[model samples]
Target chain A: MSKESIILLLFIMVLFIIGGCQTQELNESGVVAGLGIDLEEEELQVSMQMARPALPGQSSGSEPAFEVVSAKGRSLSEGLRKITLLFPRNPLVAQANLLVIGEELAKTDLALIADSILRNPSIRKNAVVVVAREVSPKDVLNTQVAMESLSATAIPRMLRNQERQMGIYQEVSLEEFLNKLARPGVDPTAPAVTLIDSINGKAIRLEGTAVFKGREMAGYLDSRESRGLRFLNPGRIQGGLINIPAPFEGPGRVGIEIIRSQTKVEAANTDGQIVMRITYIGEGNYYEQTGEADILRLENIPVLESICAEQIKSDMQACIKQAQKLKSDIFGWGNIVYSQHPAVWAELGPDWEEIFPGVKTEIKVEFELRRTYVTDQSLHYQ
Target chain B: MLGSCYDLHEINDAAIAQNFSLDLLENGQVAFLAQTTQPVPRSETGETQPSQNISVMGTGRTAAEAARGMFLHFSRLFLWIHANTLFIGENLARQDLTLISDFLMRNRNLRFQTCVYLVCGVSIQDIHKAMNERGFAITSARGITQQIETQAEELGYYTPLANIELLERMLTPGIEPALPQLTVIKEGDKDRIVLQGMGVIKNNRLIGKLNPEQSQGYYYLQSKKKQGGLISIAWSDSPNAMAVMHCTQFTSNTRPFIQEGKLNMKIDIKCELQYLETIGDDNIYVPANQQRLEYLAEEKIKQQVRSCIIQAQQLNSDILGWGLTTARYQPGWWEDMAAQWDQVFPVVGSQVEVECILCSDGLSRESFRFN
Candidate 1:
């Protein structure tokens, strides 16, 4: 053959090779919707939840669904490999909406668990991190959702709701918790989740929060205190209120909540005292109505003011008391002291826990009930 | 082309051989006047222009000796800047005349820079005047103060999310109480000596000036408990007033080990005065019901304050001065205390007591009963 013909033959071969690789299915795969991490006693537990595609024009509806697979090994990567054995096709990459940690495993040791998270490149740092407070994380992941096609998509929407609400329940991003674990002054807190079983069977429930001081389970802030505990950073929340029945109207009570808060802390003497204040503005909606007094009466305003003050005082005290009991300055008090009165904090030395319980508090709260939300003093009066 | 090449070599040789001369301002110190980033036309000789604005702090005997302290201080600041590079660049890249006052307090070596402190020492009016003279718009820069937001995406430490606002990271303190850990108390009366350094901050700066009376007020404000014979005054009550003006109804339960059902918190509190202003006939008279109100306010105040303190404990927020209290009371407590403080605070068993002192409401308490 002539040299020109040989060159043309090579070009034709190149076209044939390119054509062989042109199908869209060969390049793109699938997306994962949810992930579950469990500790299998002696080995690592890993699970993946993916949204399966629906059949077109089938006799039955395509109703959204997902398949659950389990893998176990000494390490997360190895566990993933074991799980892959159960699937025919490769797991497609998609938005991972939720990550669930089993209660039994979460309580055992978090350091290794966190390491697995750090190593997984597919795992998103901001994926909702929840610890199964009572039920197994795998069980929580298994629950079916009626609204959404897949539980993977449904679970995250639930967590995101809580995130938008009061924002005290920290989202516990993998990166943030890890950063906090490494810092001495700062500690980590994760949302506690549980599977609740009613007459209808199991459902997901947000328990409260798990406080971690230095990568160890320090303690927990119950639901009420957790509401206030979450106020420490506010994270993504704009502002929220904790409705405590205000002591204004007789019988029925008004709902009072803090609309905004600001905190300042400092140390005075070397290792001596740290003074902090949660300066907040309280706003509320009236849940109670009484006929004897007008809600708009200026004289009644004092009653409303006192109710607001007491509520704030209670919230602030609950936060402090919890910090003292847990011995973990999860509120970043150590950082406050160090930043404000480093000299004094230094004198106290390394053991800040001992120095924390005896600490005194100076709290100041300001309240403004923007509106009564209604004009009528009472349902009976109206 | 040959001639040009020969000339280029001569120029390079001359630049390498010539010794740079300098006449630095010698004020017996090392002043690091930041070189303006603007480029200046080289003198006909193409020599670099000298700056006369750098004023660095120095503690050494010689100019070179002083350079070490200045450099050390700057090094610390540089590290902070490096750690928060993105935050700084996003927030303060445009702001001129950076004041390093609070920064100096943390690093005492920069005490000489106090005169240059801007946010606190200089009044807003003064700042306005200076800015006018400098031909800079007050609201020109887009700072966090202007952009109120809730969500912030992390773009390597600094997000466009309000770095100049709530989390501006200003290297100074603000108007609220400094962190009350190290209080400087001076003994005096009506025209009193100021007590500084509670370390309370507002807007990222320290405003540490508390009079003895205000200190007592601060204590009362935190405690929510009234002490015997301590007078409080509230002139006109408004909902928007600071905590200093509001009355509080304090409640608490101090039973030991009450974590389960019917967990009782020994609670008591009633509305009591939080502020005072000595005025004419419309004023709250100190002697009117002094004896009776004093007794009532004591327990009530204590309960209110304790509730606040306890709530901080419950949330593990540490809003109270417990760390300092422990540090002062039990300095070596952390050796064993640190391990248990978190668990101990929420369940600390103690006697709960409260009382409500009724001050003659200028508006009159009888008004509530009649209305």
Candidate 2:
């Protein structure tokens, strides 16, 4: 062959080689959007939310958006492979963004599941992890959402929205969770999910923060406690509201909108006694008032500030107390001592748990009111 | 061999799915819901109208069986590559999530970026009925994702999580997962889906939920980025007097130490804000008034942070990941106490320091006083 022909032949051969790999056509592969894992009767139950594409020139009016397939086996791999028996197309999980863990499986041992997920090369490491509360993962994957076409995608969006608007829960990704697990002093937590009865019907909601001891779950933090946990973390707070009794002698209340906040904790070895000094500073705007008090005057502002400070001091104290009661170092006090006073930690390390409950604390709070929105005067009624 | 078209598949032959949902029936069977978009033809002007959405339901003893059942009602093979959302019905979410996580991690066709949501206060059937009644298009998977991407940071309402992240939290030792919750509200004759707060998961079970306020606290604790939101302060002297500030910038720093053999943490937060609106006749531009405003803002933030901390302690859930900080800074002490860290967390004391700066005043420096 001529030189050009030879080159052309090589190019054609390269094309064939590239296309020769075991590649399934779009129609031959079932794309998975979500996956659920459950353990029942010592068997692994796996469910997959598979996408169903709408083809052109076909009657797609009655077709659904996706389908769910499930199988049971002794192992996760076996269960997933068994899906082929029921699903005609090869199951593909590379696109899945949501993973649900059954309550039983999460309680038993997540090490095996973690191993399987980490070992898998095709799985994405950024998928959102959730624990099914009082429900099975299969059922979660099967539910429909009114706002979004798929609940799998909508769920994560909802989490993001909650994080931004409420600042009550943190979303943990696979990679971030693994990093925390591998760390020494930190315990892992995951968002809990459940179904609830609403006026429209049964809906999905994120309920609480799951507390973990080692690999197993220790307990959970209710909404209030969860917010307290966020407060302990210096920068976790975004925006929230604080309601305080009107800083005057009246049966009224004032609502403050948080704009910025910071917390500082110092551990001092004062005269052989461990004392934790917590200073919290915050900034916000005047939001609402429920009583007919002209507390907006410049003279009364200082009193309002002090009252708000008192409220904060009490809240931090309560959070600390709750952590003490749970016996879970969700606050990392032990870690704090170890880092700040290595010598002291060395002596008290073994007995840190016993020493923690007796630790003394001093709290100082300062608040600043930044701006008044819209108007500068209260409504004067006849 | 020459590249052949032996495995060629036409787009017209496949069913493109946009959303997937799972529900548990009272009969112990799993129900699957799928929402697919139909291909729309172009008009004579070469413009295509919106595609039609179709819904299909299937039920079976297992997830795989239910999926197979979907084929009975439909003729085309289901394609999941484009599907990006999954919904868990109340019954299913309350039961367990193991099956879902296991299936997702092992499957090759699934993407780890798909979002997960828990259905609360409503059933999948109810949602379907609501959609049918309104004749609304259910292709909102992209819309929800877009909303989260565009608004989450500014709104401070929810945190978005994907499949791999959820599994990692369950499998990881130190941190836990917090998933976003969803619920439907009936407005007039229409039903609207809204994001609630978040669910706290322990050992893969949903134990409780964080309200919107608590959820905001959670977000604030972990957020490092500059946030945009409104902070409103109420005047104690006047019931109807209020002031609102728009947060322009925020930063938080934490310091952990051992003082007097006690574990203590020091936190410093700084915020920059703009004066937006007020309900009372106060010239905040006056130096004294500005100082007062700053104090009020600081006090409000301090109180909010403190309240959040108290609430967390009550729940005994360390969504704060404070343990990680301790472990990193004080490895020696953490080693001995890691096993019983839970016992040490509650008593840990903290100090918070906050500073607020008012950067600007909207349009007019003086309040609009009526004669």
Candidate 3:
């Protein structure tokens, strides 16, 4: 080879080496999928859930799908350093999907826990935030569920299901949750997670809700209350089921599947007495019938509707009552008042909590029964 | 020139962050919380689980300082590009959003589309902890924030408040910024992060909020990217039966007028919707019934707009940007009253004209074909 050609080849090789050495190799560092925080015995506990990519020596034919390690220290940075001491791999969270907090930690001052998670430049802000209930976040991080091989993957999917379904639960990210926490004249809420013993075995189910009053655990809403609150909120009702007494069917109950519904909230302030009017316009189809009387009689449809409306009202009332009793404006009634009557709201802004309970509310429900299953009459009569 | 490079580090020596949050410390300093990913190696046993992250914190007098302090004892380089969202805590948002906003805007790694959330009722620390939890309760699900921002009107009162857009609104004249409200609710076994509605921010502070219903109206008047909204109307005066419409393809045209030296706004809204469902005894097969439904929609929509305007005036935060719209139409009049927008906006009267065209009702109008 000529000397010039040899120099060119060496130059190209040098360029390749320089370019490739700093490039990140996937296997060198484990991919981070999730993170968790908990305050244990006045100590900071940080946990990491990582994916096990096959690497040398440890890969040995097969490898565990995930590796979780936690460390505790006096400070958050100390806790984080201890995690590296406990685990062999460096946690890379570029692709992580979620962050979790133990209920115990959530109940305490949150600003402390958030400082560590927000300061790091390596972490993204879009990961979903989940609060563990009746269990430490670490326990939740350790358990693996079906549908997704990793707990991190499965949990986000489960959250999506909740958002698309009956709205019995809610999903929030770090940014969105913090936004609510910062804003005044409004409170924040999130869905609750609990380990349940089901027919399929121990699994994670997001149920009810956790109501917050100024960063503290103020109250809660059951599944029914959640559904009722969803009805009150002006949003799309994607899929939900409501059951009512089928008196015409002789003491049986019937279920109606909500295809879509719309709610309107209007508030008026007259002479300082606030009157809030709520209207629920629902269009649903008859999905189930354990009743006897032929609801297809056309005349019975109105009765069924009235019954449905009554049941919905009761559900809404229960949720509203709880919110008022707890003095937590989960429904944003104070905001509504402020929006409708800004001048009046200016006066009531500081004392919203005092006036929230006494504000009279009127709830009206209207049901449009679109259809009654495939057959006009229940199969029992047929 | 085969020179040795000294700055190269292995990927294992770097911390990759997935979630980032901003808060204020007690000493009036900027505090950062980052949820970073940790790669765990598999043991000889072929069993490897996935999805693990670690949180690192830093505190400094300025946001940048605190972010830098996060690496006090850590030896790895911190990467900022992977974070997907930025949360401003209650104290951070209330004190001065610019504490984090100025840094995030200047950051070269972070994108403008990063979802920015206003923390209302909970602490960012709790949010970070929950973001790391598994088996998140349905009620407490950390929902897809991107989806919520895009389809904010789905719950009736938000527009996509991306970082760039939010900053522009804060800087723009005759307009204020708003963001999706995130809160944690505890009910029984469920502790959920609910995107309740919109938080109105004026002068870099949260002044008020738009409830879900008011949020729907706010979207109609203020937001430009109007997708569709869930509209409910009373079919009759009896309040017995109602019709629900899922409307899309919305367009709003606002006409500003200088009447008697006072600001008057006439908003003309045009939208098409498919009748999704009705809870009334009225039959849809008759064309007259369809027209009646449309008329009811028009009236209901007018009422909705009126209430929305009323709310905007009450806040004295022109979130609807009515002043800006008027400015676009009448530059001379806008200049005359622009400085006095705060006063003019409160007394400004609006008239709404709605044309709701019910294009299609789903197949098989009646429950049974025989009927």
Candidate 4:
């Protein structure tokens, strides 16, 4: 090689060496799938749930069969740093799927918890957030799942299932919470998680939603009200069963798994009271049929429709009753007044909770079963 | 030889390709809306001058009007970023409004005029129609409930204030007749619908009148193949019992644009369900006695299914999303309809076709009991 060529080759080698040394890994490492934040006395406690690689002979049947570590510090970030101090592996959260706040932590100053989560660069803004109700969030994070290996993945999936099947607490991610923390008249909700232990085994149960009027916890909606909140806030996608009464089968019911649902909220001025109208359209499949009535009959559809309406009404009532009793705005009632009818909201003044209790809400639902996969309209008996 | 060498060097320099910077095609008028610390003054000579930098207040008519103006003014800035743009931000924070609005207005020469967001107190749908009057594009935010709450918190007004109390405390009765504020009163079966964005159904059909909650459920069950969520259910062990629950999260990852010709909204839901906080039994079996588990499962699912569908229905209107759907689904429509989206949303046609497949019957199916 020529002398100049030799020099160029050396320069190129140096560039490659520098590039290799500076390159960062794109994949998440030592990522804890689930994390729990709790406050004890004056210290902040952080619990992390991470999935460890299984041994060659180890089975991956029991999910969240990983490792859990915890530490306490003056702050959430400090607590997290303490975790890294104890473990050789660097903690990562870019792929974290859930963040659980202990019930006590959620009550007073959530802004501190929210700020720490928002400031983290590796944390995903879309990660689901929740409030632990029945027990410490760490317990729920440590619960074993039969399918997924990480409780982080399992917990989020379980919550997502609730959204699809039943619109309860509308899903709120870290990014979403930040945005809600900035609005003028609306609030946000995060689902509550609890660890359920029974003779059968252990499972993570969805309790209800935690309501935040702003950055502060206003109150919590009971599960039924959470259902109403879900119905009122259809932006979340939920899948679940809706049952209707069957006339021919006495007290028997027919179950349909909801494939899709949407809601329209209207705030209007009528007379002197604030009138809120919530109209919804739902579509689902007749997943299970136990009654004598034929599923294929077009005429029977109307009868089924009537039954469905009654069911929805009762469901909505259950939600409304809970919200009213609790004096919480999990359904975004304040939002409706503030955004749609600001003028009225302005007049209602400071006692929104008091007015909320008396505010009239009318829920209207529309259910349609557009298709039935069954080919035969009637079961033929020879 | 020296002359030739110099010529060669010049030729090499001239041969370098010129970098191409794509410029946006300029079109339409730009309007500025912002909440300023000082009121804008119109000159006696009929001259309009941009006055005082707007602080972007959370409330007040000036703030609302200014935010609306700034959004229109900043349309150009967004157009520059996305040359063939439709929707822009789904839900921008209140603090960021001033910057974004300023950016949009400064780029007045851009092709598109719409700067759609999930929730921008002001509507851009009408501006698009007036300017482009042609086809347009749109964008949206996935989960927006948090956005609304965040906006309020950012503005320093997180709590829901009782309007009457505030007004009563602020102004004495002698001042101005407290304007008769518009309110929605619902008594018994009647709900006074406000905001033309509201939709009503009766017996599962679009019967002009606002259907009762029960009727609305019937409409959803009859029209769609799937119920969105379960709101209430009876434990298989106790057929007469009911539990109220809610979904905390709902999300869908179906990009219908890539998979199918139809524009589909994907959904996944998570809920916190409550039923008589004290459950007599957590593990209740279906088919309590001499009956199939499927029989009870069917009944329990149908009852609360309709209730969950309502949330979905409201979202489809593009109102709940902070106008994100309008920004995504119909950018062109949003541009044309931005001004009146609030009014038009209620009357907008909402059709969501569904297909639900049950994957599990829980422990009830396996442990169903029959006498």
Winner by DockQ:
3
Per-candidate TM-score, chain A: 0.80, 0.81, 0.84, 0.82
Give one digit per residue, the lDDT tens place, for model 2 in A54-87.
5543423344467889999888888888999998
DockQ of every candidate structure? 0.01, 0.01, 0.02, 0.01
The per-residue C-alpha lDDT of model 1 at residue B326 equals 48
TM-score per candidate, chains pooled: 0.45, 0.48, 0.48, 0.45
The i-RMS of every model, in angstroms, reads 30.0, 22.0, 25.2, 30.4
> Which candidate gets the maximum lDDT versus the true structure?
3
Report the Cα lDDT for residue A207, model 1.
69
Q: Write the per-residue lDDT of candidate 4 for residues A1-382, one digit (tens) a residue.
A: 8999999999999999887864445343576787888877767889888778655334433243678888889888899899977776777767677888887777767776777777888778888888888588777677764334566775665565445434444557878777676654456678877755421256566667787655567677775567666667745344545555554755334555566777888877798588889888887655434322355478877766667766776778777776667666556677778887788888875768678777787888887765544332422111
Worst 10 residues of 4 chain A by lDDT: A373-382
TM-score-superior candidate, 3 or 4: 3
On DockQ, the stronger of 1 and 2 is 2
In candidate 2, position B270 carries an lDDT of: 83
Clash total of candidate 3? 140
Q: After superposition, how far is residue A27 of candidate 4 from its true place, in Å?
A: 9.9
The positional error of residue B199 in candidate 4, measured at the CA in angstroms, is 54
Ranking by lDDT: 3, 2, 4, 1
